[model samples]
Target: MAQREAFAGIMLENENMTIAPGAAEDDRLDYFVHKDGLTFAGTHLIIDLWGGEGLNDADLIETTLRRAIDVAGATLLHFHIHAFEPDGLSGVAVLAESHISFHSWPERDYMALDIFMCGKTDPYKAIPILREAFKPETLQLNEIKRGIVS
Candidate 1:
């Protein structure tokens, strides 16, 4: 009876495992261990960046947005920029593979940048690059993950 129980236990363990080391085995291993293709549901970031010297240039804002799209491999569907009396503001929304976005307020030496991307995209890279380009005296960054119920 003891030998029979041991054999049954071994059979059960093997039954839960795969026989071949093919795609199915790989998938099983991934499901049991690796998290390679796993991704976040979505990410929303609202950034209030303040600048000091020459950060309010319209050219700079345009260049930064264009460069960001290139670097992130994002798609720019539409953009709206307004330069007010005291300061200028530029807002752009890009339709990216990960998600959508908004960037604005470069006239008053301040800009607000909001980015939302789902799946496999990296929005964090934009922050350090923008910090260097804008040279803000003070900055505020807010990040919120959206649509992550499961």
Candidate 2:
């Protein structure tokens, strides 16, 4: 009997593996399924927020991040926030699975966020919390899957 599997862009046939045509070598193992056969390592969300409100308050930022963590069903280990000079905020929520972080420029009404979570956590669930907290006029989001393939 022969078995085949496709991981990222590479094809595994029995004991032989080959990269799919036009697939970059570096992209070969960007995503893969775990041994349990039901989960990947994690999901990474890169978000750009524009014309948002409350981007300067460090307290609000921390609270919102906590809410996001809860909404995503992730476990929080610790979190920290810094209020920038004049008007801005930066923070990170460290989770057992991974982390959620952001940098905000209140003067420009812009914010950038990275939310990465692994091990059964659904990072996409945090989007609604972010929308309610920031109320951004424009939102740009990108999702990437990260893991190892064997």
TM-score of each: 0.60, 0.72
Q: Write the per-residue lDDT of candidate 1 for residues 40-146, one digit (tens) a residue.
A: 45666788877644444667776776676556556676655556556655555555344434444545566667877554455666776677777778878887766
Stretches > 4 Å off in candidate 1: 1-40, 53-55, 98-108
Q: Which residues of candidate 2, in runs, are more than 4 Å off?
A: 1-39, 148-150
lDDT of each: 0.58, 0.80
Error of 1 at 81 (Å): 1.8
What is the Å distance of residue 120 in model 1 from its true position? Answer: 2.0
Candidate 1: worst-modelled 10 consecutive residues by lDDT: 27-36
Q: In candidate 1, which residue pairs get closer than 3 Å at backbone N, Cα or C atoms, i.e. clash?
A: 88-107, 98-118
Question: Against the true structure, whose TM-score is highest?
Answer: 2
lDDT of 2: 0.80
